[model samples]
Target: MAATHDAFTTGKDDGDLRRRNIQTHEKANGGMVYKIEAEDTKKLQKKSNLVAFLDEWEFVIAPLIFTALAFFTRMWRIGLSPIVTWDEAHFGKFGSHYLKREFYFDVHPPLGKMLVGLSGYIAGYNGSFEFKSGERYPEELNYTSMRVFNAFFGAVCIPLAYFTARELNFKRPTVWLVTLMVLCENSYATISRFILLDSMLLCFTFTTTLCWARFHRLQKESFSPEWFFWLFLTGLSIGCVCSVKWVGLFCTALVGLYTVEDLWNKFGDLKMPKVELASHVAARVVGLIVVPMLVYMFSFYLHFLILENSGPGDAQMSSLFQANLRGTEVGKNSPLEVAYGSKATLKNMGYGGGLLHSHVQTYPEGSNQQQVTCYHHKDANNDWFFYPNRDHMDFNPETADVKLVANNDVIRLIHAQTGRNLHSHTVPAPVTKADNEVSCYGNTTIGDDKDHWTIEVVNDAVSSDYSKIRTLTTAFRLRHTVLGCYLRAGNVNLPQWGFKQIETTCVKENKPKDVYTHWNVEAHWNDKLPPGEAKNYKSPFLRDFIHLNVAMMTSNNALVPDPDKQDDLASQYWQWPILNVGLRMCSWDDNTVKYFLLGNPIVYWGSTASLGAIALLILWYLIRWQRGYEELSQHDIDFIHYSAIYPVVGWFLHYLPFVAMARVTYVHHYYPALYFAILSAGFVMDWTTQKLGRRVRWSVYILLYAAVIGLFVLFKDIVFGMQGSHQQWRYLKWFDSWRIVDQ
Candidate 1:
């Protein structure tokens, strides 16, 4: 019986029978055990080693090959257009500003622009050219190097995605699919070939996700150096993400959610002690929260350090802040003094409200007085004179004792040119209909009770001397004495008649936390006082950083479009997932070098369909689990929950937030979300193939690959600036909303 068992196990051959075999006979039991000869064992071990070696090589070699292909596709013909496209104009100009050490304002945070500047400076760009959209790059400029810089970061996204997939325990085929999808996506290719922040954002996001996954995988070896390194890297990447755009907060929120879940998991583990769990929590807090905060602030430090000179962005900041910047009108150490009847520009201490302004235009339908609004730009219209109540008395600084407008003093602000007092009436504001409208009323040297405002110094005693009210530095609130309301800029923009400036309103409810009512005397003009001393002044970095963040938040909130206006490129959040609209990047009369920013229809639609499929599959799995009729293996369950659901969560985090936004959105806003959808598709396809016959699985993969490559080829001309004819573009246009007409 032992010989027969050995023969069957070794395969029926005379050589096998002659080979030595170890046989053990049981004394009590009736069974016999036999082991293979040494030679046979060595052969088996050799075969196992060979298989292992091949598997290792496949994992490394395949991904490397795919990465090379992605890089080649991303960089090929990248600079052929030689024209600024879409956001490249804005970002490239910003980069030039950085190189010139000139300050500029942008809706986005400064890190992305700083990186662009670094790249261009290294590439020999002299910071001399205006990067206006549709303008040709100078023949002597090495624009290709800057474009290549962006492409390099963009190319890194492919490998980062591959590593992220592998870290999530996805199979080799799944990783390959994700890499190919990113490589062939036309929107990514086009955007990467320009000086845009999106590619850098994508790179940071992917790296953060990869690091997060790696950290979790290394958790079993608790507190290992490798674990801490990955964890720290994740935090650093999150900082990079935020330093690019505010949208990166969504990614930070994702990591925060994951960390909470991870900690909860540790809490539930029976083997982990309370001390260990506390340590884990402490580590994550330091790594994720503290680390990211430091890095974000450091980026701002670099920004402030480099942009020491004032330029276009001066108007966006406080007058005192601008005075500190080199090349500004005021010297750095300008004295903090305000005199009665002094012409000045008042700034709202509220986050991003602008300088107090009054223009020739009147409120169209309400109040009918000269429109008093908060204009963001510095202009002559913003000039006003401070007077003592209805008397309109001017303080004699030379002959009489210089008396500052002390706290609790009633003051009237009169428009310098219009000679009308700043007034607030019971009439509703145009935009914020609930608040009383603020306007310019009564003629110079004469005013009604509506123009009288009592000054209440913020964070100061009522008995404080007027001399203590430092110009630009001190904050004060102006309360309308007649109406018993606080004067404020409510972030509501007036119509075109008011020059589209922010609405100035009077609110009855004085909420303690409401900063919109706070005001500061920004610029004071007095001929009596000697020119203020000029000292090399440095603005407080932390205060400026905080103020800048608040300003950015307020500015972003005010970016919604007017309901009466229409934007052809503006798309709804739902429209983005469906590819309903495409942005027009650049177009010429002859259609030469025309670049339209649109994704490959097949790729976009396919990813959308796959996302739906994944959702349905998750729902089915949940229903099956509840019914107890179908059961999944442990490995399958883990893959479904961790590997599949992770990317889906990221997709939702990045995409779903856009639904809440009222601002104009474009198709490119959906690219980050599309990445996760592609990953989900790879996971689903790999899972499906595992259940199919080998030939059928391979055929499905081959067909899908062919489709992606074919679609990319078909749309290559438009994305790569190959100058296709009108007839050819018409053939490629799959949707009417594409708006791909020849220019």
Candidate 2:
């Protein structure tokens, strides 16, 4: 009776459990249980959303901290060491001129000065022609004020960089890294601390590129009005850049080129018919090429119209009037005369004129000197071609008159009295009272030497008298007079009389034999000669000597003779771009501290290396073979494209002032080449981030990139700043010394 009772209880328990299971299954099928779980799922969904929010916060929060850090870095000691650099002094002088209604030479485009002038006007500097002594403003409007103005622009660049990085879809870490580097870069930092146009130009260019990248990235989105808006902004920024410098043309060119390339690639993949492809190409040309150019032109037109209406106070100008006033207009010549100088009145003085004139040195009287004939025979009808050079003519040096004959010596004479070359010790016939009407020889000295008509070296005052002489109007003037530049009067007149002859002695085979009379050849005379074999004519002996010196330098051996200046990169490295005040910052006064910024070998080399890395990355992405492996997400790719293309191209474009300086001297050309190199580093870091991110985890990639940057920073410190003071080194490379303290 007890066993039976226990079984009945067990059976009852089983039946109750079965009934519970069946009820649960039925509720699930009816969506009742699901409804209950849905409540739990809603809680879970809320929790998941919270987790995602937290993750995003963690990711972006660090970058925000970094951004704040960058801001402080730029702002810290902003005006603490507001010493004016050489460029600052130049710009400051120009700003003062704007107040005085005095126009300085427009070596740089008008936009940068316009911005500086605006700053001056705000500080009560009106465009007044009031000052006679050149002191345009009172003490309040000094370099300090200008520096403060620069600081404002500097601050603006930080946010611009952030926007640029963000548009590129740069990872949080990448954005932070770029921001930090830009804020800390000595070049950008140093430029920002003074009233110079470079920083401002950079800001405008960066902003434009940012806008362009943003527009390109948003083009695929459903409601892509952002693309058009950004495109307009890009146009404006480009205009602003061009207003500051003509190089901005390249910025637009790069954009147009990129757009076309992208269109071709995208459409080519779709396998469209030939006619459709052509139509597509035409459409792309309209959208990317024509539209962007129209936008750029329109921006300029706005400036043009504004200047036209606003009268004298308007800073925005096309400089059409100024350009016309300054005489950029070239009078139209007959086609025959343009291609080949008309020999209608040719007498014994007949020579190949126009751009094709062969400029050969005439043998000086008395000595049997071999004439260095420049083979520059370019036919007007036929294109130029290659030719083998015959042996040099052995001139009888003992004779008073040098009779040069061919086939004996290595140097051959191709023609007589071609053109004047100062380095070649050749001088052309000077302007005479008869030829004084021509402006080409306006500053040349002319004297009639009894029987021998000789041109004497006279002051410019005397040269003007000779230039005004209508009788001696020499027609077959060398193109050097028109296109080739000449030496500055100041350079010709050495300030320190005792330091007249700066010798660059070339030690050949371990013995100093052949010497370059002027150590600064560019400073002494203009190097304007027609294209010829002599273009690449470096003395073989000199080349070998330089090679030996460079080898020693690269090996850490002292190459330069100066023990006191042993810290110079020249002493340890014989490189193309010499690191000294003589080459890099030629316009700056050598005695000043700013001179150190010039002729810096390490910085130039570093920059070059950076460019190499950038080119490699660009090539990697551009070519089909490498593109697949080095593929970047579209957003990242656009960023890479802008950063890689604009900066490098802009380096050349914005370098007009420096390139212009090259016509006057050699030093100003350094910045373009050097900056190209430095900006290249930024591109490399960016490319590496993309590359590493694709293969590994993003965190690991970020850490690795940072480590590489750290290594680069180390290299910059140790290698580039070898002789500099620790403070100066840090200040120059990394703008914030507090970073060192923080570290």
Candidate 3:
């Protein structure tokens, strides 16, 4: 016989039900068993609370511990500065732009800034502060909460590393080591303890990596709901990472390479049915490609919907798009058609093109006349008067017939700001030597035959209609009457003396089909003409998204280092891996705490060396395999692919592209690459331990933990809080090139 009784509990049960203990037990054969005493039952009751967590030590307990450490480290004295730091000034201002719901343009996508704005909103920040660098924050602002919000993302990265390693089938110490490395990464902690977007970017980058690992493990579970769930999650992560920064594409590239290899391998599986193969390919297409594209587009849709009002970034978009902004006056009462004496602004139709403009300054090298260039900003200098050619007809108000400008009309464009006429000459252009030099010459009343231009309306690309000229629709090319050269403004930048504006020239080759020569009247003002119907100018979401992205790339590429200006904070790609430099995260002064972005030396050097070792080992192993050696087992092959090769590919995908990039590089740019390198190091360390003896394995683990921890202790203040003179931290000045100490 068996009997049971409910036990007295000190606390309420948070699990399925209260615990039950048997006063007496009986076996299936009806044999009596030993009974539990009250003393033992009380002890069991005391420890019953931990049963739920203890059972899932690897899945639950490990992550919880790592997460707590990560959050504690990141959030420790996070608001010590109490002032705007480097990049915080810019990113925080962008957040304020979002809070204000005003349209703004940046080289990066909107999602990161949107999250910052959301954090600010959640923190009860009024978004009234401009976030100027080194400026003291207001007492009313809850800067701490905002910092904590961003730090939350960085904190989550530790658990993500742990989970990713688990999915890759890494053993105990390797998983723990990987998580610890990220947990103690001072640079990540430092970058996250602010209102910048890098932490959020890092978070999503890690999320994508983890999701890819999970999806990769489910290859055998192909087409299952669980497989589709993980794959869909991977796609969502890709969208999220890319939405933060273009650097996120490196993460996407790694996932893409793995997918391609997987599909190719599946293609060779002859036993697989034809229908199944097609299903696999279709599933991957929808899950990876289409899903990511839709998610990316959805972010832009929200961006467009939120920013309905016009602001500083209005001119960076298409004229049609800008005209639709809430406060824009471009098409409110502006004319619909082009006519003689119409004051208008002509925008170049080429990618990254700008508005045709003229200023009081003259080009020092070109024609030595007033500088006529394509400028990105909208101003009075961009305005021009469409005056009829003196030989053709009078444009005077009393005698003018008000003839509407049509295809092939001869005209003269006089700058409204300086009263200069647009003229072209045979002089070699400063930037493009093959093109004729375009300049502003003479006044409204004084000019020559060189000032005469024939405006040829370009046929509509979609409908082929080219009879009448209209604002923001009809594209026209200006042909010099005497020289027969077409007016063009390509993305070429003029010399510094030319204010770095886009170079405007007359293409001497007479390529009528060239988009650089095509121009459209963007802003028109003619009291004689009626207002255009706003209903006819609807800007589609896809067109705006594509145009904005191209413009962003053009602007981002334009950020090449200017030799004339030396920026000390800027570092080269070669300097990143070797810890050759450190960046000042804020203005160095005694008034505020200083934070420097230098990673723990052991972590940095060890990870980099591990990456190198993997490269060499793979080369040697490949050559041996090609020579018909069966030195590796099935387990080894799996380990190489899942543990070593994945991280190696990810690291290269993230790092190697920086070597070819011309944009200004920074130390933070390497953080994503650093993540993959750390994983590679984990792989190396695990493999080495596997092959070593018991004593040697134990010794290696102890030495590594000590070194990583010791260095982090020495450099902890760099991220946590450092004050006083550089002399105080001179012990950390291992590399002289690292601006750790002042002159």
Global lDDT of model 2: 0.39
Of the candidates shown, which would achieve the greatest lDDT relative to the real structure?
A: 3
The residue-by-residue lDDT of candidate 1 on 1-743, one tens digit each, is 11111111111233343433332222323443223345565775676577557556766786688779777877888878777777888999999999989878778899999999998898999899899878889987789999899899888988888777777766555566677788888888877888999999888888888888778777777788878888899899999899998778888987888888889888899997889989999999999999999989999889988998888887677655777777876434334566675677888867666888988878779878788889888788888877777653554334655556777888888898898988998999888888898899987656688889988878421225543556666678889989989989866777777767788999889864577888877677766555454333345677678777887876787678777788776788898777787777776456557777778776788778887888899899889889985678886786787667777888899998888888777778888888878878878886777766656766777788788888888888767775755556788667787777643
Q: How close is candidate 1 to the true structure, as a TM-score?
A: 0.90
In candidate 3, residue 509 scores what lDDT?
Answer: 82
Q: Given candidate 2, what's the lDDT at residue 199? A: 64
lDDT of 3 by residue, 219-315 (tens): 8788888899999999899998888899999999898898889889889999999899899889879888888888888888988898888877877
List, in order, the clash count of every candidate structure: 0, 21, 0
Better of 1 and 3 by lDDT: 3
In candidate 2, which residue ranges exceed 4 Å CA deviation? 1-71, 81-83, 126-138, 221-224, 263-743
The global C-alpha lDDT for each of the candidates, from Candidate 1 onward, is: 0.77, 0.39, 0.83
Q: Model 2 — which ten-residue stretch has the worst lDDT?
A: 517-526
lDDT of 2 by residue, 1-743 (tens): 11111111101123345447656776768856665555655765676677556545644564466556544544444443324444555676666655554434334545677667767777675544232222223454444555557666665666666555555554444455455555544444444555678666766767766676666666554125554566567666766766665555556665666666766676766665677567546754554456655554553333333332222221111111222212111111111111011111110111111111122222333121222211112222111111111211232223324221111111111121321112211233121111111111100122111101111112121123322111112111111122232111111111122122111111112111111110110000011212111112222323322332232222222111333333222211222233333212212222323322332233444455666677776776678545466446775565566666656665555444343331222333243334434445555655564435343545654674565446445434321223323344444444221222112
Pick by lDDT: 1 or 2, better one: 1
RMSD of each: 6.1, 19.1, 7.6
